[model samples]
Target: MASAAFEDIAETFEFLDDWEDRYRHVIELGKAMPPLDPAFKVPATKVDGCASQVWLRPVVSGQGPAAVFDFQGDSDAMIVRGLIAILHALYAGLTLAQVGQVDAGFELGRLGLNEHLSAQRSNGVRAMVERIRSVAAV
Candidate 1:
């Protein structure tokens, strides 16, 4: 099951004026996620170009607006783990169109982390998006 809706995440970030608080919230989200099986963390699902080791497993169901997509992801870095959790909260169980509709840049910008994120972290997240796009396309 998904955590709080992405809307709730947005609201929480909006209410948290302090960046540290928002970052803490995201970290907590990551901590709450159940660990993935070691068997699923193979090189085949590894995300390329990430500064830290990361893996994503995706499951797609139904079709069109009725589609539901869920992903399990993990990262060796704590913050990256949190970022992966954010993606899952926002996208898990959503339709293919809904997944395509996620404006991650805008969302992060709204959360005020767009300018604050390091280039490497940003690139890692961009890779995450590309991976999600590819899986959903299939």
Candidate 2:
């Protein structure tokens, strides 16, 4: 399920008629995110299958399934960084258990991202989603 923040993004996407404008909005969302610390950009946090270098560091609060799930992500590519922000909006603040239940594709599809992204970018997004899910699963 999408979070309120993500719903907001979807609403914005709906308001913006042009794919170019949506693309710019995504980049702007990426720019708005705080940069992840360089130290966290290590191999351990790096997401595989991404065309661009990307890292996601999980920050769990509390314990067990009830723990809140949050992460800090960064990317060398601006659009990838924005993608990370979108993922953050999708999964962050959710319970660690809840994170696993999110249908990332369907939620993202609501914003029509699948049609706009290149195949590589689509794969990259899947990789990122898997990374987030894996972290929450543990």
The candidate that wins on lDDT is 2
What range of 10 consecutive residues in model 1 has the weakest lDDT sum? 1-10
Q: What's the TM for model 2?
A: 0.99
RMSD of every prediction: 2.7, 0.5
Name the lDDT value of residue 128 in candidate 2.
Answer: 95
Which digits, one per residue and each the tens of the lDDT, describe model 1 over residues 61-106?
Answer: 7776567889898988888888898888778877776677777777
Among residues 3 or more apart in sequence or in different chains, the pairs in candidate 2 whose N, CA or C atoms overlap within 3 Å are none
> Scored by CA lDDT, what does every candidate get?
0.82, 0.96
**For model 2, what is the alpha-carbon lDDT of residue 14?**
96
**Judged by lDDT against the true structure, how good is candidate 2?**
0.96
- Per TM-score, the best of the predicted structures is 2
What is residue 8's positional error in candidate 1, in angstroms? 0.7
Q: For model 2, where is the 10-residue window of minimal lDDT? A: 36-45
